[model samples]
Target chain A: MDALVIGTIIKVVLVLLIVSALAGFGTYIERKVLAFMQRRLGPTHVGPFGLLQIAADGIKLFTKEDIIPQHANKFIFSLAPVITAATAFIALSAVPLFPTFVIPESLPLIGGAIVPSVIADVNIGILFVLGMMAAGLYGPLLAGMAQANKWGILGSARTAVQFLSYEVVTGLSVLAPIMLVGSLSLIDFNSAQAGGIGSWIIWQQPVAFVLFLIAGFAETNRTPFDLLEHEAEIISGYVTEYSGLRWGMFFIGEYSNMFTVSILAAVIFCGGYGDLGFIPGSLALLLKVVFFFFLMLWVRASWPHIRPDQLMWLCWKVLMPLAVVNIVITGIVVMI
Target chain B: MFEQIAFYLFSFLTIGLFLVTVFSNNILYAMTSLAAGMVLIAGFFFLNGADFLGVVQIIVYVGAVMALYAFGMMFFNVTKVVKEKNTSNLLVLFLGVSIALLMVIMFLSPIVPEAIFASVPPEPNATNPEAVGMVLFSKYLVPFEVSAVMLLIAMIGGIILAGKKMDQSLTKIEDEIISEKDVK
Candidate 1:
């Protein structure tokens, strides 16, 4: 096989294994973080500092029964979680996870292949990532609609509204940075800010950064914009009827998406994979991603989720217009 | 060799998905198949090296347009079989045949002489999106702005049509009904 093909396969496998494991680990982190915030010990009985709680949960989920509701559309119900997980991973293909590394020539059959940080690295990397994430909306939407439960229907309706509304903001907000960089590739975005912290796009386009972050929260179905699956309003929303590995797939997809958004934010605004002073490129990027991930957990612990109507209002009446204005301002600045 | 395999595989999958879209009795099946077909159509654009167009195809068609279609499909009973009342089979056949013929002619037109082909050949060094932008902003500016205006008008019309009872809130209406009952 060709070196390029082998490298890509390796990258894909690595991304799949690492990201899914990280996603499972994320649940454990969230529990611990939330527990500390609420002043309690979380899952201490399971393992040391509850580190092995992820394994325990994984085993429980794997052993749990897979149940399909009697009236549900079985095909779609089964396909939904797969779509969620698949699109999440698909979106990651274009993302430059870390600095590219080459294996030593003496290693093995797959040796000497330089594995690029991104798997696909298409010209329109940012758009491709956004499109895949957008496609991920169908997972929950289809799952809810196919389930034949009223709560599921309500959840899917909210999913449609939330995803569609925020997508506009996401696109428009990101457009300012794209305009400034003059390229849609995230690698280019990283390189554009390679001069140092001062050259970061966030300094010039803070509004876009903030808007993108907000929309990113909504896109990932994080706390403030988690109307799609708000337990208080709609019993687990789209995942109400789901159980076992099927439900685990949705959980994995959500956490994977959270990572994608964090990595994107780091790369786009915070000088992704670019060196900061003495910090190496890879370590810098890792720090940024970790901070963003921690920020999400922090926000989840601190703030309250909004109502469905309020979410729509914020998206259309507030965020969308602000994104458009930011784009206009960015265009004017670029023109000058 | 890889391109040939990919092209053939995508073509087969696209056709199969579209066929499911057309012939499926269940609405959910039809909608899901249609969305999948749209994604496969994007694969065609990618195969042609139009990366920008492919991403836009996925973002606009599969991500937005088909999503909206699915949203509308949710109002219907998805599991229930859809029964079409074919009042005139001959008419259906005639329409389908003509549309297919028209599409064939359309596809063939660019191959023939003086059939209004590419006004601007793609620049060698530029990316797909840059080339598209250059052509769109320079040559096709008027038509693009005109379409945008038309879309804006359509959007306003839709808002007006849908928001006829904009002032009346459901909660307020419920309150009014309760007050009237108390008064009575």
Candidate 2:
């Protein structure tokens, strides 16, 4: 096989394996964090400090029976989970998790191979990632509509509004940073912030950073904004009709999206994969992502989900306006 | 070689999906297919090396616009939304869009494939979003600004429509509360 093809294949497999595992591990992290916050030992029996719990859950989800509603559109019902899972994974292709590295020529099959951190280094990297994540709304939307259940439809409806409204905030808030960086590529965003702690875009675009973080939670359907799957009101919303592994796919997709959002926040606002003092680029990037992930869990544990009306009200009346103002200010700053 | 194969595959899927989007009996399924088809067109842009345009297409069309369509669908009864396919308007749209799509595809596809096999690959700017930005802000600046203005107008129009709807709903809710008070 050609070297380019081989390199691309390697990146694809690496992204798929590492990200899927991270998604599962995210559940473990969430449980552990929420547990700690509430003063409880979370899943101590599963594995050493419950590190292997993700594996256990994975097995359970996989082995569980796949149930289909009799009235559901069989093809679409089955396709929904795959779409969520697939799109979640696809979005990661543009995200630069680590810095690029080149292999030494001593390698046998592959010699002097340069492997970029990203699977696809498309120019419009951030936009592609946002697009893929937004497209993720369809998974739950379709799943709910196809399930032939009222709760499913309600869940999907909420999903649509939640994803759509937050999307404007996400794009507008991120626009400031993109304008500052002058490139849509995530790698460019990272490089533009290469000057240590103080050089991070967050320091400059503080409002955009905060707005993007809040909007990120809504986009990922995280707590305080997780109206799409709010258990108390909507009865698990879009997943009301989902079960077993099918339901697990949504979980995985959500977690993966969380990771994607965290990565975006870290890269666009915080210093991205750039090295900080002694820390290597990749490790620094991972640390930023880990911090963001923990923040999501912390918010989830402490905050209550908002009402649907409030959710929309916040999006349009507050967040969107804030984002637009931020963008305009950013444009002026860039021009000057 | 891989690019050619991908182009053919994506084009084929886009055409097939358009057919599915129009012909499907389930409005839910049809809308979903339409979203997928739009994304597949983005695939063509990606294949042609217009990465910026491709991502923009997905962001604007699939992400924002289609989600609006899906949300609109949510308010309607699913059974009622799926209109009978025999309508002349539907037929006209299907025929017109398909023909236009095919014509564009044919014109865009490599002319005399062998004679111009891989002639100066379509998009050199694929790796440079900044280049696209430069061109847009320089050469196409006026049109771009005009489009932004148009979008602002559209936003105002949407707000007006939504505001009227809200007023109607609010009055209805007020009527219900008043009736309950009388009963009490």
lDDT of 2 by residue, B15-89 (tens): 898899877777766777788888889988888677888888888886655565665555665533455645588
Q: What is the lDDT of residue B73 in candidate 1?
A: 59
Q: Residue by residue across B52-126, what tens digits does model 1's lDDT show?
A: 999999988865654665556556777678787789989999999998999999889978778786668899999
Query: Over the stretch A1-336, how does candidate 2's per-residue lDDT look in tens digits?
Result: 687778888889988888888888888888988999999989898878988888889899999888898888778888888889899999988898788887788988667777788888887889999999988878888888888888888888787778767888888888888889878888888888888898999989999999999999988889999888888987888788788899998888988999999999998988888888999999998999999999999999999888877777788889889888888988998899
lDDT: worst 10-residue window of model 2 chain B: B118-127
* Quality class of the docking in candidate 2, CAPRI style: acceptable
What is the CA-based DockQ of model 1? 0.56
The prediction achieving the highest TM-score against the true structure is 1
| Clashing pairs for predicted structure model 1, backbone only | none
Fnat, model by model in order, equals: 0.51, 0.54
TM-score of chain B of 2: 0.66
Instruction: Please give the lDDT score at residue A213 for candidate 1.
Output: 95
